[model samples]
Target: MASANATQSVYLDYAATTPTDPRVVEAMLPYFTEIYGNAHSGHRPGRRAEQAVEDARETVARILNCKPSEIVFTSGGTESVNLAIRGVTLSEKGDSAKHIVSSAIEHSAVLKTLEQMASTNGIEYTLLPVSQEAVVDPETLIPALQPNTALVSVMAANNEVGTIQPISALAAQAKARGVLMHTDAVQAAGQLPLDVQALGVDMLSLSAHKFYGPKGVGALYVRDGIRLTPSQTGGSHEEGQRAGTVNTPGVVGLAKALQLAYDEFDERTAHYRSLRDQLIDEVLRLVPNARLTGHSEQRLPGHASFLLDGLDGNTLIMHLDMKGLAASSASACKTGNPEPSSVLLAMGVPYETAFGSLRLTIGKDTTETDIEYSVSVLAQIVEKLYRLRQNYR
Candidate 1:
């Protein structure tokens, strides 16, 4: 049962960002106050900071099943993706290794970088189409591969609708033809079994904030033999692949958070799956002309998304906000895009339905009462929005 004086607003937008864990906070506090020195410095204080960074790297490497030297720390998922794509481009046999392949529903970080590279640097890219459920068939992607393709990038999970991709199979397929494979695993880091060896990807990216850690910290996993040119040229750092003073506190927080996530994976996953199922069932029962988005059973355990007729997602989200329920209409990164979702359009959803997208994701501590409250609140908001739209029509 919920406390009578408990919080009013339900945070159902974990896909956008999750609150930092308290254990992670405890782990980071020492780095900020006692060990406040740049990792680049060589003094005792700097060496302490550098040692903390290396410890964090080893922790992350343990989870990824990769060597500590293979992990490159960055600001976050966006910077990590930018580094991966650009680093590959710079290292590729110039002109000959100009082509790349990716999925259409990838995050803006991937899509935008590819666009910039293609337009400004003369790189060529092909985006494979997805099913209406926002999934890529390896067959579609394999056919688009070229002999000169430098890399093949795909997300482990779709941030908008939470569709899981077959990263292992896709990576195996891409590598068979000598192309390197990369996965934007930002959304899947804590939610899935993300063993790099099992996934077989040459590169992977993760953001700490997405899994209850501090913001402005993330890591990229580059396979042992794969070489990437430094994206940011500066003082040697991150094995000379990325350059900057390491963020000791944030990195420590990230490792602590990831450790907690793995330790509690089963229990947390069960809770999220139950709440997600409840959300889906209650919405379909209460709302008219509502259809679930993405693969019903294969999506992230915490993700619940839908499309409702005669409703715009932004408009619905506004009303939900007033009612103290938080949600999203599209990928959080593409919030202001008035156009229909690129992911939905790629999935072949009609413009009208795609325009009405709603995504609600639960987090590790989201209680049963919270899910109940959100479902009730969402039903009310959808009815209000439907009536308003009908009256206007």
Candidate 2:
């Protein structure tokens, strides 16, 4: 029951979600209290609320370098992913375009949606394998595409291992084959460049909570000429793409948070990389048989995942929490599954090694002191566990 540092608690789970910025809260305040009119109503208050929604859409469009009309608001990353994949495949003209090509290490939102479609809608998909570094090779993706392939979906980065994928390269190949490309940018939204034109993707997904914005709000970027079947019907909201009353305050918060993140991107990433590298180096040096999981150089600045030999990942997480250091065994989406991470297994990690996985993602508030304390706590826990195992054996 000893505290990790005996001084303070450290949170290294930014990949799960981020603490919303106070500035974003400030921007969203008026919408909740004063401008609380329905966006679709034909009245003065409604007009004002509609303007605010449009303004927020414009802000998100500017960030993604897409037209405002191409952006559709959704509940969160899961909805965005579902919409992008299902909307396209279910369109009126989509009967002949049912096959999809994607990476094996995609987030479950993407994988599960595909599985659902395959079961009920006669959709077929190919999941390309990744390298040992957890990167999807563009060369491997080419053969996965078929004459009937409709879309190529891949994540901008690995949610669990933090490995950055070659999205541009993958999208380019899809484009050359006359196929549409989509990327789930939930994990990469605030930390990575999201210029849709540059990424060569026809559609991209974003979740506000990943970038210090409110939860329950996300956006899907579709190119101007792309056609999609409305996933949620009955209203003209989101240009008839989704049906529901617009979340004015949440959208305002999303825009403000994205603006602040990009404005401070250089400084924030430098801070994250500094602390992250220190933690990684110290943990590997101090703990025997510890191995870094993702691509060492191409991973997220704030992300560091690893495999600790001869330890259960969940057990390690419990010990870290007891010591006042918060972390994860894998993606928060798969928290209670009790199964080894599919991401690591897809990257060819042995099942036993995959069970020892640990993920520590630093955030804007992380510091050198926090990283130092986290490393000390993690090393001690691993050493103690190893000693106990030796004695038991």
Candidate 3:
């Protein structure tokens, strides 16, 4: 039995990627062995693989509340985002307009691709700002819409701050103006309830790793009737939307992960919220001059981001790691660089505060004891670092 004083390490970076659940592992084992086959083959082995892929696609589609035909399997979240943004822009019918609207807080995958399109393809774009709560204002986008605007891409939830966006409202606004909408929902898929129809988005992106499935597999939901140009060319696969041999095991794992996510979403959310609240409460009680980041109530259930005054986030993270608690200074994707978090900058966070940020995301396996222990360990480290900084000053 687990206890409060257990020697096991605590991992609080679920936003980066979750460990594969045993159930998902079980679901994927067969695909890797007896059922292994090329989804494109016409033989018995091929037929088995093809059917498994189709079934996985259906499972993903059902979770998103979209048709199976709308789901296109890709390598991961980056590919899905690239395909959604570039595919729509490149496939636009006319030459009169070539512009897009996205936020500054988007992942590098989305931002870098848009930047490349702007430079090489002459695709002009606008990057909107976010509030202190890290939520983008839908009204800010109204004045930016041009007749040439091909699509508007925004994240459903911020990876660093965990602030949920007003996706439905934003998508509706874009739709009313005849512009397409796409959202990078990699961080929100399993943590929140998703309904593509209700969200009113033309395209959506999700990755398996973020939801406790295997890495290197993701899906894109393209609304019916939206024309998209294929980025990769090969024989007809994924209905010619995406091409290449499908990773049968990866797809099977993703479907199982998503199914488990949906089946236990309510209970998991509640459990994580309870632990998150306990963490925040204990941290505030034990640590001085630590402030929570992101929206107080509108954030993800398990996301607990904060800034510790006068302490370098990287140093703090290292200290915590030495103490056997794993956390991140910001999004795992943006770490190891000296620059402050772009998401925090977009929300108008000062450079100093942004540099001192830490993100601790709980998960299904996290317990109150884990939160308590983590808080205790972090408090000791922060105080030591703060004293050292003060002495140097």
On residues 1-393, what C-alpha lDDT tens digit does candidate 3 reach at each position? 123334459999999889999999999999888998898899999999999999999999898999999999999999999999989999886765599999989999899999999899999999988898888899999998998999999999988989999999999999999999999999998888879999999999999999899999999999999867878888678888887888999999999999999999999999889989888887778877889889999999889998876667888888888878999987797778889888877888888878889999999999877887888788778888888888998
Look at candidate 1 and tell me the lDDT of residue 371: 76
Alpha-carbon lDDT of model 2:
0.90
Give the whole-model CA lDDT for all candidates, comma-separated: 0.88, 0.90, 0.89
lDDT string, candidate 1, 124-206, tens digits: 99999999898899988778988779999999999998999989989999989988899999999889987999999989999
TM-score of 2: 0.97
Off by over 4 Å in 1: 1-7
What is candidate 1's local distance difference test score? Answer: 0.88
What value does the lDDT take at residue 390 in candidate 3?
A: 82
Report the candidate with higher lDDT, 1 versus 2.
2
Better of 1 and 3 by lDDT: 3
How do these models rank on TM-score, best leading? 2, 1, 3
